[model samples]
Target: MFDLNTLVRPNILTLEPYRCARDDFKVGILLDANENTHGPALSEISETEKFLELNRYPDPHQHELKQQIINFRNSKPNQYSEQPLEIENLCLGVGSDESIDMLLRCCCKPGEDKLLICPPTYGMYNICATINDVEIVRIPLTVPDFQIDSNAILNKITEDPNIKLLYLTSPGNPTAKLINVESIIDLLKRSSSKWNGLIVVDEAYIDFTLPNGSYSQSMSTLVNQFPNLVVLQTLSKSFGLAGIRLGITYTNKKLSKLLNSMKYPYNISSLTSNVALKATTKEGISIMQDYVKKIIEQREIVLNKILDLKYVGKNLGGKDANFILVEILDKFGKPSNEIASKLYNTLAVDNSVVVRFRGNELNCFGGLRISIGTEEENKTLLYKFERVLNELNA
Candidate 1:
């Protein structure tokens, strides 16, 4: 049996969550929590409808928001679950970063336990491990395709009983490739017998997985089936809600409760919750889907046009996410970090057409990760990118 308590830290299991004033009551005179009853000090003449309740604390539990998210996920065309998502199966966070940090804290025992990560994935997994004083066991994804090395990961997990958490990124950062679902399922199966660790699948770009902006391959559907599985998602990418900093964690009900217990009371602000609530509604989701359609169209346009550049080599990574990773070629027709770095700097400093330089990452030599932007923005990027490559390639 996969025991959640065995995997979690003893202290975290016993830790009492902080209770806020909003927990018990939300109506009548709320003097329990000190606040400016007069409301936010803003211009009375200003449009303050959205920012109306600045004086009152946000709902710590966020019942309505969580229900909306569950409905959204369950309504997806490909989202399958034996027991459909419930409010208890969801936990809200500032961003996926908070959930990552919380999981590290809950499972890893400082310097003793280990957190496994696949290289060229999301950097936050490694950063959060460091912050929580947990050691990282790096298992680099197989080269060229950037797919998971299932055998290698299983071997490592079996060898190290101390590996408390395994972080996998779908449509990964820089790589922009989805780790195979079968591989993930295999890892989860092994955790039952060989190891007892939580498997975190970060799906920040999952909304862009299908052409229709649906997370057809999302690991979220498996959360109800597997207690050890935790799927992380956010509104930052496809939803265009980065400023709000809303992240959703989908897992089993018990694990979700544990995560809720560990989080600070009133973590989700009133403003954020309001915006997120609106965004997850049926109409809001339709708007987000339309945006995804536009982005995918732009992504393809950029991919085809970018390859035409003289210095640009073969495209790297699957174009599952809203970005494209292409190599910079040298005079010898080999991937060149020197040319890539120079082009990255020249574009940002001179042309202001900024993209990421991911040459430093494993197997991503001379790589430039370009995010798909608006139609006009992409045109500008292509124009500037070709101009810079011409100057640098020579």
Candidate 2:
């Protein structure tokens, strides 16, 4: 029998999560949770007299928000043409960070069970595992291309039954590479019975891959076909709602229920939920799509400009994300951490422009990860970068 309970930690299986005071009733002149009945002391700024319900607890289920997400996902045209996901297949977290932490807590027993990660990827996975006291197995991606060493990953998982979660960041961090969908499918097929684990694909930058607003590259729709898959997405990157801290996990209904049950009763605040609803509306999506198109265009421009610079070396990995990774080279045209560090510091300190120095990451020595910004911002960055390189060389 295929049982999810067997994979979950014993403590988590019997865990009785905290129920907030607002659970019993939402509408009342409620003195239920010892909350102050008196409204805030601040003066009302709006002439229309709008209240943010600061005195009350937000919805525990976030039914309306999940419905909005479902609508958003279904609206996209995907290669799989999978069935539209209902609320049962969705769960919201503060950000993908929260969801990562939750998954580690629910499935992996502290100090006993393990989570596997392909580094030169998201750092949060490793950090979350450490925080939860869960063991982590590192399988670094193949250098240059930044592709997953599928055979090595499979070998590690097969050898150790303790690994309960495997994290793969699509359009990866720093590298900006997309792991092939066929490779993922092959891994899924091989690990089906041998490994009773979840494959968590973080698609935080998937929006950039949608050049024409198509979902052809997203593995989110694969959740229906692969029961062990959980795709994590966020409003932070594309939708420009980083401050609201809204993240989503799309998975099978059973896992969704468990995640929801384990999460804080009211994980999302009323204000955040309301803003997210507005952002996910038809008009909001159109605006977001237009912004994404502009970003992709800017990314291309930045990539070409960087390549033209004498100090810049190989453009590592696939440039699918809104960022590009380029190595900073010495005068002799070799990757140099010293040169990269100097350039990064000069850009930030002298030029008032900053790009991430990824020189310390594996296989990314002397690398700088530059995010695609607005046209004016990109031009400023390029100009600053050119001046900095000339100064460093001089």
TM of each candidate vs. truth:
0.96, 0.95
RMSD of 2: 1.9
Candidate 2 C-alpha lDDT tens digits along 1-394: 1258798777777777678667766776788777767754557645322466666667888888788888888767356646777888988999999999999988998889999999898889888999999988999999878888989998999899899899999989988988887788788878877888988899999888853445667777678777888899999998999999999999888788888889988789988988899899888989998999999889889999889998898897677888999989998888999999999988999889988899999889999988899999999999989888977887
Candidate 1 has which clashing residue pairs, if any? none
> Candidate 2 clashing pairs?
none
Candidate 1's TM-score: 0.96
Q: Write the per-residue lDDT of candidate 1 for residues 225-292, one digit (tens) a residue.
A: 88889999999998999999999999889888888999988889888988898999999999999999
The global C-alpha lDDT for each of the candidates, from Candidate 1 onward, is 0.86, 0.85
lDDT of 2 at 239: 96
lDDT of 1: 0.86
Worst 10 residues of 2 by lDDT: 41-50
